[model samples]
Target: MTQIAYFEPSYTAHNARDWEIRGSYKYPSLLGDLHTMAKITLLMPTLPPETDPHRIMLETNYDVRFVALDTLDDAGDANIESLVEDYATAIANLEPDIVSTLNGRMIGHNFALARAAKAVGKDFVYRIAGNDIATQIAVREAAGRPVTGTAYLATLIAQERYAAEVARSVIVMGGTERERAAGRVADPSKIHICRRGVDQSHFTPAANASKSCNRILFVGRNSAEKGIDLIEGAADMLAKTRPEIEFTVAGDFDPRTEGNRHYLGFHGYADLPTLYQDHDALLLPARSEGFPQVVMEAMSCGLPAILSKSLFEHDFGAGDGVTLIDRDVRSIVDAISSWHDDDSLFAKVRSEAIGQAKEHFDATENGEHYHTILLGQGK
Candidate 1:
C-alpha cells in the first residue's frame, strides 16, 4: 500500500516551531489530501514516549503514530553518530517501509529517523526549506569570491559533494529559480523541486475593509533576514510623507525593539487574516525566502505588496501588484505613495495579487504532489 512514515521533528506546532507546518497543514485545499495519505505515521521525538490513541486521533489521520527520543537541539553542531544510536532502536520497534523527513537533516528528530533509515536499509526521503539550502549556496558563493579564492571554493566544493553523496533522495521547495538550478545536480533525479502552494479562500479581500484604517502589516520573526530594519526605515519615510498611515509588525514582535513599529504580536489564524484584510498592503523585504508563505497569505487577503527585488522574481512577478525595491527606504516610500494616490490601480494590483496566490501557493495541490511522490506516482 506504499506505506511511508512522515518524519517531522514533531506534529504539534509547539515543538517544530518553523514555517513549514502552517504552510502544509493549514492550507485549506492541501490538508484534505494530507489526511488521506496511505498509512500516514507521524514519527516525532517523544519523551514520555508510548504512542497514544489521542495523538493519532488528534492528527485526524488514524494511521498516525509517535516515537519519543532524547531531546537534542537541532541548531547545535550535531553529527550522525548519536542520532543513529537514538533512532535505530525506535525504527526497529516501529518497522516502517519508508521514511520521509520534511525538514531533513537540519531538524533534530528527523536526524534520528534518517539514521534509522540508513541502518535498516530503508528509503530516506529528505525535504529542505529555502533557507537551509540557500545558506549552503551562499557559503559556496562567498567562498568563490576573490577574497576566498580557489582554496576556499575547493573546500566548499568537497562539502557540497558530500551533501550530494548522502541521502537516498531529496525534496526541495524552490522559492527562486536559483534554488531550482542549484538542486539539479544535488543528486541526479533524487532531488526534485516540490513547489509550495497557497490558499485563496481565506485570503480574499475583506468585505468589512470599508471600516478598516490605513495600515500596512509585516508578518514574520524579528530577524536580520526578514528585513525588519529596512521596513522600519521605509516606515520612517512614510511617517514623513503620510503622517496618517500606520505600520504594524506581527509575530516574534517586540514593541521596544522596532523603532516605530506598532507590535501586534503573534495572532492565531482567525485574527491574522483580519490583520491582512484591514491593512492597506503587506511589506516583506526578505533577505532570503523559499516561496514565502507569508507573501501568499498576504496576497490572499487582497493586500498588495512592497517586497524586495529578491522576492518578486519569476512567476512571482513584480508589477504594480508588487512594489519591488532594492532594499532602499526611498523605494519603499515611493511604492506606498503610488498605491495611496491611485484607487483603481491599487484595486487592480490587489486583484492580481489574489489571483496569483490562488494559482501558485495552494498547499492542497502541494500535498497532492507529496502523496504522489511517496506513493511512487511522482508529480
Candidate 2:
C-alpha cells in the first residue's frame, strides 16, 4: 500500500481526544475510508500530551503521529529555520510517498510542513478549504493597499503563492476555487475539484418532521464574515412582525437570549444531526466560504437553507434546496418570511435538499474520489 502522511496541525491533543470520544464523522470517516486503500498516518503537533497515540489508534482505528512543533507561536522568525529542519527530519523519517495538508495559507505550521515535504523529495499536496487568501489579495489590490511590500499581509501572500507553485497538486472544493487557484498556480492542470461530502446515513430527515419554518438555524462563528449581524438583525425584526419565529445559533460564540434569538453555544459533530433535524431551515449569510459542511449536513437532514449570494460565486448552494439573498438584514428577513408563509415552497425545498445530499454529497462516494486523488490515479 502507498504510504501517505496527512499533516493537520489544527487537531491538537485535546481536540483529537474530543473527536474520538464524540465520534466525529468528518475526519474519522474520511480517514477510515482512506485507511482501506493506503497506509495513512495522521501527523499532528506535539501538544501538552493528554491522549496516548496507541489508544487513539486503537479506538479511532487509524494511525496518529506527533511532531516537535506545538503551535503557530513556535513558527516565528526566531525559530523558523530550526522548525523547518526539525519538520523535514520528521518527514524524512516517516518515508511517506506523499505529504498532504489542509489550506494553502503557507503560514506557521503549514509553511514548515510544505518546506519539509519538498526537502524530503515527497510529492506535496495542498488542499484548499476556502478562498480567504485569494480574496484578501484581491481586496488589498482593489483598495490600493500594497500586496508586495514588506508588510505582514504581503509576506503571507507571497508565501501562499510560493506554496501553490511548489505543490505537485492543489485540491479545491469547487469550480470557483479551481478558478481562484488557476490564477495563483502556474499550472492549472494541477488544480483538482473535489468537494467535501455529507454522511447521508447519519444526517437523515427527521421522522414526521414538522415543515413549519418557525425555527431558523445558523451554524457558524458569530463573526461579521459569518453575517451574524444580519442573522441577529433579521431575528430582531422578525420578533416584532413574526414573533413566533425563533433563531438558534450553534457555534463557539457566547449565548444571548435577546428577543427571539437563542444561542446553543458550541456543538460537536455528533450533536449536529439532531440540531439540524430540530430546526426548520438553515441560514448562513457568510461573506465568503468554500463548500460549508454545515450546509451539507443541514441539507442531508432535509432542512432548507437561506444563504448569501456571495457563496454562489464558489458554486455553493447553486441548485435547488437553497434561497440566495444579498448580504443585508432585510434580505435575510424576507427569505425567512417567505419560507414561513409558503408551505408548498418549504416542502419542495426540503425534498430537493435531501435529493441533492443523496445525489451529490454522499460521503462514501466522495471518499472514493478522494482516494483516487491521493493514489495519483485521478485529478
Candidate 3:
C-alpha cells in the first residue's frame, strides 16, 4: 500500500467531485491507483476534521486515504513549526509508498510533505499550475520591483532549485507552440500534462424539442485573456443578422478591467449539463489555454463548440469536438452560421464531439494516466 498526500487550496469546491468524491464515483484520483497495484491515499489540507484520510479512506473500494493539513485559507502561511509536526504525524499514520499533489495549490502541504519525505529519504513531486508559472515568470521579469516584492515567486523558485530537481516532477498542462519553441516542454518523459478533464455525466447535452429559442452559451471568466471581446463581437453580429438568437455569458466577470457584458456570475460544475442543454452552442474564443476544460465539458453534453483556433491547432485538435475559428469576430459569426444552416453537418460533428469526450476526457482514463505516473509506468 502506498500513501499519496494531496495539498490543495480547498476541499468543498463547486468543481470536480473526483478529488472530493461527493455525488458519485469520480475516476480521476483513486480508481486508477487501485487498478495499478497501489493503495492511493488522498489528503485534502483544506477540508474539515471528520473527512480526514483515516475516515474517508474507508468510504470507497478504491483503497484510498484522505487527510487534511489545515483549514487555513491563506497560501503564504509562514508559521509551520507546529503544522509541519502535524503533517509528520499524518504521514506516519498513512505510511504511503509515494506522495504527490493532484493539482498544484497545496505548495505549503507539498513542502511540508517533502521535508518529511526527506527525513526518511523518500521521493516526492510538487505539482504546479499555469497561474503559478505565469506568476513566477512575471516576478523574475518585473522591472524595478524590490526583491521582497515577489517573495512568493522567489520562494517557489528557490524550493525547485534546492530540492533534488530530478525528484520533483512539475505536472504541467501540455505546452503551447510558443512554450514548445521556448523549450518549456522539451522532454515529454519528464513533464506530464494533465490537462482539462470532463465530468461527462453532467456536461452531456439534451434536445431542445419544443421550440424556437436559439441559445448561445458562453462559460468562463469574463477577462481580456478569456477573449470576451471576441465572443461579444460575434454575439453582436449574430444579433444583427438573426435578431432572434439569445446569447448568454455564464460565469464570473471582472467589471473593472474587461468592461461589462451579460453575466451569470459563477455556476457550479453540476449545473453545466443543464447549462449546455439550454444552449445551442458553446463559444470560447479564449486567447490562451494550457487546456480548455469548458470546451470539453460542452462537447460531452453533445453540444457543438466554436473554440479558438489557437487551441484547435494542437496535436489532438482535429479529432476533438471543436469548430475551429480565428479570433476575428466575423469568423465566429460565420462558423455559427454554417452550423445553423447545415443541420446534417451539425448532427455529424455533434456526435463526433460526444465520442471524443467519452474517449479522451473520461475520468477513468485520466486516473489511469496518473496511476501510471505514480507507479513509474511507461510513457
lDDT of each: 0.61, 0.73, 0.59
Name the weakest run of 10 consecutive residues (lDDT summed) in model 1: 22-31
TM-score preference between candidates 1 and 3, better one: 1
- Listed per model in order, the count of residue pairs whose N, CA or C atoms clash below 3 Å is 10, 0, 11
Per-residue lDDT over 1-379 for candidate 2, one digit per residue giving the tens place of the 0 to 100 score: 7888766554443455444432345465455467666776655554324465443553457553444433343555566677678768767888899888632333555566678888889888878777665445545665677554547666665666777787888777766667767887778998887766877878899998886789999998655467787788999899999999999988877877877888977776678889998999999987767677888889999998888776665564545788889999999989999989988888888888888788888887877887777678966
Candidate 2 C-alpha error for residue 122, in Å: 0.9
Best lDDT goes to which candidate? Answer: 2
Output the lDDT of residue 98, model 2.
Answer: 87
Q: All candidates' TM-scores?
A: 0.78, 0.86, 0.70
Mind giving the per-residue lDDT tens digits that candidate 1 earns over 77-189?
35445666656765666676677754434433444555567788777665655544344444445456352345544544443344334556556665453355355454466
Error of 3 at 239 (Å): 1.9
Scored by lDDT, model 2 comes in at 0.73
**Which is superior by lDDT, 1 or 3?**
1
Model 3, 50-115: lDDT tens per residue?
Answer: 544423444454554455654343435574445556655666666665656655453454555567
* Sliding window of 10 residues with minimal summed lDDT for model 3: 253-262
TM-score of 3: 0.70
